[model samples]
Structures are given as C-alpha cells and as structure tokens.
Target: MSGTRATADLAARYRVAVEADDPRVLIPLYDPGALLDVHVPHWRFQVEGRRPIAEQVCVLPRPGRFTTFDGEATRDGLLVRFEWRQNGPTGDALVRQLHAWRLRDGRITEHLVFCAGVWDRELQQRMAVEAPLVRP
Candidate 1:
C-alpha cells in the first residue's frame, strides 16, 4: 500500500482502539521502543516502549463518554484530533487533543499529544485554545 494509505489505515485503527478503551489493541501498531510524549494542561511526561504506552492508554476514559475522532495521513505519519465529553464535578467536562504519530515500517516510532485543559460546560463552548505545536 501507499504510505499515505497505510498511515490513514493505522490511524483509523488507533482511533477505534481508543474509542473502545482497549489499549491492548494498539500494541501491534507501535514499535517495541516507541516513544510517546504527552502534554496536557495539568501534566507533561514522556513514556517509552510499547508496554508503557499501553499502560498510559489504559488510564484514559473508557466507554460511556461521548467522543469525536478525526485523522489524516501526513508525509511520514498521521495527525489525529479528537474531542471527548464526560461527567464532571459541576457539569459535563470536555477535553480536546491532537495526536501526531511518526511511523516506520508500519509501526509508530514517536507519538506526540497536545491537549487543551478540561473545561466545564460553559467554558468549553467559549474557550479557544490553539495547539502548541504545529505539524512539522
């Protein structure tokens, strides 16, 4: 398959795994020594290796929440953006993020995530936060 097609397919599978809340499904998609860099409002860290990445995925919100996922293939990777909504202390909380993955030999080598802060119902609709990193 073409690189673009492969990247798109892999990205779609990644989205499916995330929506299903099953990190195990993404194991085969990553390189053994893959690196994941996560940057969110409250936390910033890096996880290396597929095992750690999977563990990180497991901690994310599972089913029962509302999510919208969109992905596209870049020259050497994939760019995916998603928004999630779930119950919160005051009302519904919303989270939005952009995930960029660099794939080699059909496996992801580097994954970077840029996230917006969790926002309450009203704030979520009114706030506009741009992603810190642009596609390179």
Candidate 2:
C-alpha cells in the first residue's frame, strides 16, 4: 500500500482496537522493537517492545468513549488528535491528546503521545473551560 493508505489503515485499525475492546488487536500495528511514549497525569511510561506495551494496554481500565480522532499523514509520520471522555464505573472525566507515530515497514516504530500537563498550564486551563461547550 501507499504511505497514505497505510497510515489510514493504521488509524482505522486503532479505532477498531478500541471498538473491539481488545488491546491485543494493537499488537500487529507495531514492530517488535517499537517504542511507546505514553504520557498521563501522574506518570509517564516510556516502553519498548511489543509484549510490554501490549501488557500495559491490556491492564488499562476501560476509559470511556473516545469521542473523536482527527488525523493527518505527515512527511515524518502520522499525527492523531484525540478527544476522549472517560466514564468508568468509578469516575468521569475528559481529555484531549495528540499522538505522533513514526511508521517504518508499515508498523509503528516510534509513538509519542502528549497528554495532560505536557503543555502550558494556561492553555490547559483554557481548554478545560472551552472543551465542554464544544461538541466532540
């Protein structure tokens, strides 16, 4: 497949993984040596290898609906911006994130995600104010 088509396939596969409620579906999307940079609120997990990454995703508590994913295929790779609202049995919350994935040989070689606290606090505060009003 062409690069654009491949990237689109990867994006579609990711959505399928979420919809299937099976993180194991993500396995084929990455290389054995793929690197994952996961940034969250209280901690950051910089993981390498398919098994470890798969394990982490498997253990993740089902965060609520991923409301939207807007993506573009770039010269370097693909950039996916996601808007999510988490409503588990325990709590409810919202988050906006950007993921940059570098693909090689049709698999994700490097994946970096920017989540809460990664950007300016003021910008986050502004987003917090505006996000609820804007429909996903």
Candidate 3:
C-alpha cells in the first residue's frame, strides 16, 4: 500500500482503539520505545516507551466519553482532532484536542497531543461544523 493509505489505515485503527478504551488494543499500535508528548494549556510532559504510553491510554476518559474523532493522513503521520465530553459536579463539560502521530514500520514512533483547554458549548458547536468528524 502507499504511505498515505497505510497511515490512513493506521489512523482508523487508532481511533478504534481510543473509542474502545482498551489499552491492550492501543498498545500494539506503538513502537516499543515510542514517545508521547502531551501539551495542554497548562501542562506539558513526555512519556517514553510503550509501557508508559499504555498506562496513559488506560487512564483516559472511557469510551463514549469522546463524542467525535476526525482524522487525516499527513505526509509523515496522522492528524486527529477529537472532542470529548465529561459529566462533573458542575455539569457536562467538553474538551477538544488535536493529536499528531508519526508512524514507522506501521507503528507509532511519536505522538503529540495539543489542547488549549476545556471548550465552551459555542466553540464546540463551531468546531463541529467547521471540522466535522470523518472516519477513515
């Protein structure tokens, strides 16, 4: 398969893993020494190796919590935009994030997450309209 097609396939599978909320399913998608860089508005850190990456994935909000996942193949990786919702004491909250992954030999070598902060309802609606989610 061509590199673009391959990455698109990988991106689809990655979305499946995320929606499944199963670390076991997600772990194999990464290289043994994979690097995950997490960058939010307030915090930034890196997780190295599959073990830690799996651990991080395990702690994410469960399946169905994420409302949408839109992705496309990049020259060297995949770029996925995700919208997630959570119910808290206050009320329902939404978060929007972008994830970029670099794959090598069909496994992810580098993954980066970017998010500004929790998104308000108006912003979420605008984003949903502007960048509607698409499956592979």
Candidate 4:
C-alpha cells in the first residue's frame, strides 16, 4: 500500500479503535515488527513488536469516552490530536494529546505520543476558577 493509503487507513483505524474500545482493530493496524515509543513525565515505554504494543493498549483501563479532533495526515504519516475525558473513580480528568504516526506499507511501523498533561499547574489553576468541584 502507498503512504497515502496507509495514512487514510490510520485515521479510520483510530476511529474504530476508540469507538469500539476494542484493541482488536488496533492491533492489526500496525506492522508485525512495529515499535511504539511513549513518553510521559514519569514513565517511558519503548515497546517493540506489534503484539506487545497491542497487549499493552488492551490492558489500558477504560475510564470514559475518548474524543479525537484536529487530525491531519500526510504522505509520510498521520497526526491525530484530541482530548480525552476520563471519568476515574475519584473524578473526571481531561487530557489532550497529539499522536504522531509513521506508516509503512499500509501499516503503522512507528508511533510517538506527545501528551499535553491535563493535571498541569496551569490547568489546575484554571480549573479551580472554572470548575472547582472537579479540580484536583
């Protein structure tokens, strides 16, 4: 498959993955030897091989609905930026992030996630004023 087709397929895959909350659709979307490099303030997981990555994602505890917006795609890859509102046991938290993807042969070979921490100080301050009850 061409890069363009791969890019288009990625967007569709994400939609199916999130909407169905099924890792099945997502797992096959990547190359057999794909790599997923995820970085956060406290944790870094450089998962290699599609099976492991899919398993990891499958274990992700679902808190609430996930929404994706402001998506863009190119011949090289696809970019999916979105906000996810997770209603945890304690309260609800909103996290926004931009996902940079690299597709090869209609499959995602590499993926990097840039997280916009929702629990940041600035967000807390804004939440305190806007929605105190939900603010942590």
Candidate 4 Cα deviation (angstroms), residue 112 = 0.6
lDDT (tens digit, per residue) of candidate 2 on 84-110: 665666555556788899988888888
The list of candidate 3 runs beyond 4 A from truth reads 87-90, 119-136
Q: Estimate each model's TM-score.
A: 0.79, 0.76, 0.75, 0.74
What RMSD does each model have against the real structure? 5.0, 4.7, 5.2, 4.9
Which regions in candidate 2 have their CA more than 4 angstroms from the true location? 57-63, 117-136
lDDT of each: 0.78, 0.75, 0.78, 0.70
lDDT of 1 at 76: 79
For candidate 1, the per-residue lDDT at 63 reads 33
lDDT of 1 by residue, 55-129 (tens): 675555333354777787888788888887766455777778888989889999999989886667677556444
Q: Give me the overall lDDT of model 2.
A: 0.75
Ordering by lDDT: 1, 3, 2, 4
Q: Would you list the clashing residue pairs of candidate 1?
A: none
As for lDDT, the candidate ahead, 1 or 2, is 1
Give the per-residue lDDT of model 4 (tens digit) for 3-114: 5655766777766676567767788888998888887667777898876776654433256566546567765778887767666775666776677888777778988877
